[model samples]
Structures are given as structure tokens and as C-alpha cells.
Target: MTAGSFLARLHGRTATGVPRWAVRVAYAISLTVLPSGLWRILSVDLRVPLMDAPTDGRPPPDWFGGEWWYVIGLSAVSETLAFLAVGLVCTWGEVWPRWIPWLRGRRVPILAAVIPAGVGATFNTLLWPYSMIMISLGRRVDGGGDLGLGTHGWQVFVFYASYWPLAAWGPLLGILTVHYYRRRKAAESVGVREDGARSPAVTVSH
Candidate 1:
């Protein structure tokens, strides 16, 4: 398939009647954490010194000592979680994929997808803003009061630019979850099964 065709299939509408915009948004959600994840890998694992080194004649933090495994693992897990948001707009979110043992091809319960995503959305929505607030107050949500970027304007700019996209992650996921819920609920209400077949309408004799 051509690239355009492949992309169309990837983001195409499924049985859920997801809008094209929503599919795009879901894809965007998967990318929201990428910058920060890459920043961590480059700064911590690769020791690219994105932040200023400590000036007190002390050695750098343990993370800067090439914590490749930890940094890579964290970034991997974060990106994987972000990618799960795509399921909200894909067929897999409504029906289990064929590879699963017993649940293969089974219709996924609505609550199964919504509850965790909803909870995650709520938590992330609160968490990032709270973190920014704490950072602004010169307090650290993760530990130290200082960000360790020192007084370099370029360093601060690059750091924030890499990390700022994270603030959109929660809101995007939340919106996508609501879209998933509405589409699925509408399908269920109209007796449309996961296969897109509608049940025969009932009639009452007068």
C-alpha cells in the first residue's frame, strides 16, 4: 500500500463511528510525551548535558552517570502509555484483537476501557498543572528546589520547550476518552454490535 493509503487505513473509521478529527487527535495524544521522553534519554542516558553541570565541585547526579536502562525504560513505558490512547479511536478498543488467548475477538466492555482512561485523564489533568505550580513556587514535585538548569537562558528555554508538550497530554486524552464513550454509547443504544450489524427493530401491535 502507498503511504497515504496506509495512513488512511490506520486512522480510518471503525465500527464506533469515530470522527476523522478524533482519530487524528488520538494520534496526536500518542506524541504528546515524546519530547520530554527524548529529553530524558538524551540528558540522562547519553549525558548530553542538556542542563548545566553542578558547579560545587561535586560529581553529577547518579542519573547523569549513564543510567541508560532506567532512562530508556521510563521513556519506553511513558510512550507506550501515551500510545494506548490510540486504542480509543481504533477497532481494538471495541473488540479484542485475535492474538489474545481467550478474549480474542470478544467485544470489550465499555467500562473496561473508560474507567482506567478516565481515571488517568483526571489524574494527569491535575498532576501536570500542579507540578508547574510547584515549580513556579521554587518547590520541586520530584525532589530538589532547583531545576539544575542554572542561569543560562538558552538552557532554560530548551528544557521548557522539550517538557512543555507534556501539559497537553492530559487534556487530549480526556477529550479522546469522551469521544470514545459517546460513540460507543451511541452504537450500543442503536443496537449496533461490534460488527456494525444492527439488531432488528421491535414493533408493538396496536
Candidate 2:
């Protein structure tokens, strides 16, 4: 099967009643994380000069001390976590996957998902905008200004352009989390009513 069809089927099985816009936003969250991940990977893995050069004639700290694998691992971990945002609108967030050993087929506790997502949203909300302003002022226009990534070169401008989208990541995740909570709550209420209706009535004999 083609990749597109495969992804559609995969997403379809997990999510029910998720709004189209929310799913789109989930995808956007993944996209927003890609550029910085790529930049980091390129700089570290390929030994490319994508990052800012050393300031003050002192060498930049060896981010893992020149270990290439560490850089790759960091990038992989980051993108994987970012991709999990899709679960907000997908079925897997509500129901445990069958592949999971003991938890399979169990109804996922709503708060289990909501709390972490909500916390992440709050943290990212505070972090990304400040980050963007710093990048815009420090790197984009300021040529190694103290507030932003302190690298000077044409590459710095490219870096700013690529990483700027990350500023939107926090707000978008916050929006998706709100929608996810509402839909899950509504579904939970409906499930509770269904269970109540199906329950057998008890009769007492005197």
C-alpha cells in the first residue's frame, strides 16, 4: 500500500470523532519540531557548520564531547516525542493498544493523558515565544547579539528562518490539548451512560 493510504488507515483506526482541524494541528506540531531537529542533526552528525561559531575565540562546549551518536539520539528522541502529539486526536490516546502487555484493551484513564499534555502545553507556551523573540533579536538582525544564538554568518539568518516556526508549537499544542480534553470528557460521559443502561436491575425477594 502507498504510504499515504497506510497513514490514513493507521490514523483512522485510533481516532474517532476527532475534528479535522485538530488532526491538522497535530500534524502541524510535528512539522514545527522538524526544522530544529534537522538543524541539530546536520550540525552534529554531518559535521556541518550549521550552528553558531564559537564566541570569544573560545571553543564551543562539545555538546556530548564530539560523540556523533549522542547527537543522533537526541534528534530521534525529540522528534519522537513531538510526534506523540498526534495521540491527542487519535484513538490510541483513549484506548490502550492491544500490543501492550497487561494494559491491552483497557480504557485509558483520561487524566493519564491530559495531565502530562496540559503540563507540556503550559511549559511550551512559556518557552517558545520567548525563544522566538530572542532568536529574532539576537540572531536574525543582531549578528551574535547576546540574547540569541550567538553565531555570525549568512547561516545564522537561515537558522532563524528555520527555527522560527517552533514559536507556534506551544500554542498549537495547548489548543489541541483543550480539544482533546473536551472530546474525551464527552465520550467518557456517554460511555458511563451506556454502561448504566446495560446494567441489570436487581430485585429483592421478601
Candidate 3:
């Protein structure tokens, strides 16, 4: 009869750990830092060489054949995806949008959400290794005295070092992913057939 009882019986799962707000904040932090690193790459700025050549009087890197816009645009998009992950933790993923025409107040399916997000979060976690490879093999270079941070061997290590928050992206998402699947599957099984027999619903229309 109570709210807690209803949720427990309905969802068949316990909602625990990583408060919704904390997840949202985590996503926000990840989203911000990600863009900075991404802008450099998309601008082809990542390979600009962090320590500088020490010979030429060059002024950072402005040369990438004017295709710099691609970097700017894409970085924005990638970061947006990171931001989206935050919504899953909050109720927004379900029914918060009121500005949109058809999408406003619509329910998002758990499976529809979990698969892509679980995959993306896992992939994002892979950045640590990828970044390491890029740094060691001279791939993800940050470039110049303008970067404000040192570009030495130990300094170059910071690229991966600062990735703690990002690394948490997957496991945190994984917990939500599991919670969603359990809740959704429970919803499916609790439905009834029209023929007066008990049966699971084929499709959830939210």
C-alpha cells in the first residue's frame, strides 16, 4: 500500500548506491573535461607536439588546412553524448522534456536505453589505455608553451592521470544499466493477456 512497497513489488529490484544527483554531477564533470581534450584532437591540435620543437619560433599550431571547424563541431557533439549519460541517473531520462513536441513527457524504454549507454560508457572507460598508447607512441600530443602544463615524459602522463572521473563512467553506468534491465523486465512479466490468461507483454509502448 505504501510507495516503497509498490516500487519493490513493481520493479523487483532495490535502488541503491550512487545517488541520482551524484551521477548527474559526475556526468557533468566528465562532459566538460572531455571537450577540452577533444577540441585539441579535432583541431588536429592533439598532435601539435606538447614540448615544442625548440628550434622554430612558431606560435603554437594553427595549421591543419582550415579544416579546424570539424574539430570544433565534433567535440561539441561528443561532449553532448557524455552529458546525456548523466540524464539516465536523473528522472529526466523518463519524463522531463516539456519543450519538445512529441517527445515531451514520454517514457524511455530501459532496454532501448541500457544497450547503447552501457556500450558507450564501457568504451569511454577504454580511453585510459587509448590515451596511454597515444601519448607513448606520440599520438595525442597537446603542444606548446600555450598549453600551460609541462609536456615532458612525466607531464605527458597527466593526460591519462587526470582520467579518473572518466574511468568511472562505465561502472557507474553499468549499475544503472543493470537496474534498468531488472526494472523493465519486471514490468514486462507483470502484465496480463487479453484472453484471460496470464502472459507477459510483448512490447512496452512507453
Q: Write the per-residue lDDT of candidate 2 for residues 88-115, one digit (tens) a residue.
A: 8776777787798999878778789888
By TM-score, the better pick of 1 and 3 is: 1
lDDT of 3 by residue, 27-57 (tens): 4545545835553573254545543443466
Q: Could you estimate the TM-score for every candidate?
A: 0.85, 0.78, 0.54
Give the root-mean-square deviation of each candidate in angstroms: 3.0, 4.9, 10.2
lDDT winner: 1
Q: Rank the candidates by lDDT, best first.
A: 1, 2, 3
- In candidate 1, stretches whose alpha carbon ends up further than 4 angstroms from where it belongs are 8-15, 56-59, 62-66, 142-144, 200-206
Task: Tally clashing residue pairs in candidate 1.
Answer: 0
lDDT of 3 at 125: 59
Worst 10 residues of 1 by lDDT: 58-67
Task: Tell me the tens digit of each residue's lDDT in model 1 across 1-206.
Answer: 89657865764344457777987788787777898889888877776867667889663465434557878888899889988888898788899988888999899999999998999888888888777666655667785767544425676677677766777888999998988898899998889988778888899999
